[model samples]
Target: MIKQVLKNVGITLALFILMINASAQKVTLLQQGRAVSIRGLSVVNDKVAWVSGNKGYVAVTKDAGKTWIWQQVRGFEQSDFRDIEAFSDKEALIMSSGTPALILKTTDGGANWQVKYRNRDTSVFLDAMDFHGKYGCAMSDPSNNHFVLFETTDKGNTWKAREMAKSPLARNDEAAFAASGTCLNIFDNGLIKSNSILMVTGGSVANMIQAHIDEKKWSTQQLPIAQGRSSAGAFSVATNGKNWVVVGGDYQRDTRTDSTACYSNDAGKTWKIAKVTPTFLSCVQHIDSKIYLATGTAGTYLSKDEGLTWTKIDGGSYNVCIKTQHGKLTLLAGGNGKIAMFSMK
Candidate 1:
């Protein structure tokens, strides 16, 4: 009887350990060497991914995250490429942030790049860009007290600024963050009439700017995340269907947890703070109905219940996180050229 009781206790302990391991996610470091800060990530599928960052640096991996090819756009070597939109292993577009703002496109991978747009305005700065199907748009920081919007319908071959009336004006100190290349998002509800563009702002306030693609009508809403200072506000916005999540915190004090994230089920109509929050997440992405990933200088976090709660999966610093649209591959990028692949067991 004593032997049987001991055996049963051992089995129970073993099963408990298995259950804990199964519920925990894992992060595997893939590549790290260079010192470039990687804030832009585009995972096309399980086999292809692209990332762009400061000093006009761009990296592509054709064999998932197993290998990477790094290059710097020759002439624009000094430019800080903050955002990237990738269509495949060979075609992608990159955007720069500061003065002499630029948008470049490459069709032959990173070997060659073509200038698609350039603005010498000292105040011009782009934050992020996104696309839904063939339509795409890029959001910029407020210039002349009005935020700038650029649209493209030909897969980023060309871009045109929408009229001022179509682009909304900015509030006092209201601006967007180029931290993780995810301040703007475009989505469609499988209906021609349901296409929309969503942009989140920081600085003096945290707000979401919503616009209808067909109507060009825009609306604004104040978010519940940290705000008021130039270093605080909503840094990223993401949506999967009608469910949306926004995350941000004072970048200067990245470890602070106050008002770092919120979620909305009715599009952008309302938002409620998460019961549990991650500290200073510069970027957030919805992987599926139940899984969401966020990252920042502090670390990487995963939320298994939509965005209501979160748990830290990795302590390594990162700036952005994204999942492949065609497969289950998830990747995170950050400073010093750090890149890692996430595995959920």
Candidate 2:
């Protein structure tokens, strides 16, 4: 009787271990390098994707994440490309942060680049950029006490700063983060067709700045996420036309799970905190109608109920996440040139 009992216990233990392993999401590293920290990612489709990062590095993969062609933009070897907008495999634009802010465009893939826009102001620092059709916008850190906004009407071929009054004034120590290149987003669904823009900020204050292309006015609202410090606040925002979600946390304390995400159904008039939150999400993207994905230094999370709750699917640090605009492919990029593709089990 004693031997039979011990044998049963051993079988149960093995089964328990297998269950635990199956529950944990698997992360398959597609490529790893130390030369660049990839924060900007644009997955045009399942077969075409582009990434830009430090050391003027830009990579493209025509076969999903299987292989990559890397190149360094000559003469801008020190530039850190934080945001990228790709229209196709042959055309793309990259924006650099910090002094001498720049927007570079490449028409011949990564073979050559042209400086589409340049700002030498010491205070000029671009945080993120988004586009719809031929119109695009890039956001900058506070300059002269107000956040700077630029518009491009020729598909990123040229850019001009909007009127100072068009942008909202920044609060003390409040600014946007270049961590994931997702602080700014533009929505242009044919139904709404209003060209609504959403920008989120952190630091001493956490707020969402909203604007419409048809209106010169911009509005700001405080968020419920963690704030009151430079490392706390909403880092990214995503909308599915009727609902919006914002994700962030005190990145300095990435393990703290409180007040890291929120959602709003009535536009931006009001917000509600998520019942369960992810930690320190640097970027969030609405994958489908009720599907959302967020990633940060702590891990990657998935939400099937429209950001109301989250589950950590992968525990690998990533700076940004983006889905293919025309396909179902989801890709993530992060520090030390890390890149991976997501697969549901």
Candidate 3:
């Protein structure tokens, strides 16, 4: 009877610990009501960050999130700058979706932007882009049954589309989500931890696409997330070297929890659907080896036990959440120019 009593007590203690880990952070809003719907976020460090959104809005902060200098690119007032990659307070690249796909680079902070790449095709829609040192890759929806890819060797100043033979083939109705710009990234991480480009697609089918630096071909793994429609599937993926976490659901059904998240430890060879998942997540960032953060239209969530379980710690609508590239400072941004900072409680 004493042993049984001790076992019950141990289980109760563990449950309590998990509960504490679930609500481990506090979110503080730094800005709101600016008339822009932010979807692009990049944190250069604890002291610098940038965000881009619809209506050609781009905001940057040099003193963390204390104040933001907002800009609306001239001659592109209607452009929706959905993804931004920042190298510092003054140099960055912004990509726009919709008809007449565009990529622009700004060297004088937000003062002027020079077009680096432009496509006026009615069917072309750029989704996301990421960099590895000076090498950068960008993705667009299918063209000629294959995903169009562009690469830049000098940061993002110039771009050239990869040969059509090298681009990954897309299924009949498969496409990528441009919600958070976290759905695609290039990193030297995985089982081997070498340079690999990873991208997630959603539509009639959901899949993960990977291309290794040493290999000449692209490979894919199906993600077990919401699918069969345009509004579902994986939206974001983050990894702490080897372990990977992917989160997304039917954005139209933002509150449903089933098939909303999953995890993989052995690269993309296999995955296990998270037992506890957050609602329709557009962005997820690895906070540490064991902690991760995700956010979407529903709210923001945190996971202390990797991606096994997540708890809603704040009820803020956001399109993207990110941590500083080299610092621990974390921030979230969404529509209506909402921006918030997350710090450990």
Assess candidate 3 and give its TM-score to the true structure. 0.94
Measured by TM-score, the strongest candidate is 3
Model 3: per-residue Cα lDDT over 1-345, one tens digit each: 999999999999999986776555788999899999999999999999999999999999999999999999998899998899999999999999997899999988899999999999988899988888898888899999899988998999889998888889899899999998988888985365466788998998889988875466888889989998989988999988667899999999999998999988776789889888888899999998789999999999988777988888888899999998698889999999999999887
The better-scoring model by TM-score among 2 and 3 is 3
lDDT of 1 at 186: 85
* Model 2, CA-based lDDT: 0.89
lDDT of 2 by residue, 202-278 (tens): 99989999878767677899999999998898899988867889999988999899999999887768899999888
lDDT tens readout by residue for model 1, 52-82: 9898799999998899999988988799989
Q: Which is the winner by TM-score between candidate 1 and candidate 2?
A: 1
User: What lDDT does the true structure give each of the candidates?
Assistant: 0.88, 0.89, 0.89
Give model 1 RMSD, 1 decimal: 3.2
Worst 10 residues of 1 by lDDT: 187-196
TM-score of each: 0.93, 0.91, 0.94
Regions of candidate 3 where Cα sits further than 4 Å from its true position: 1-23, 190-193
Off by over 4 Å in 2: 1-27, 190-193
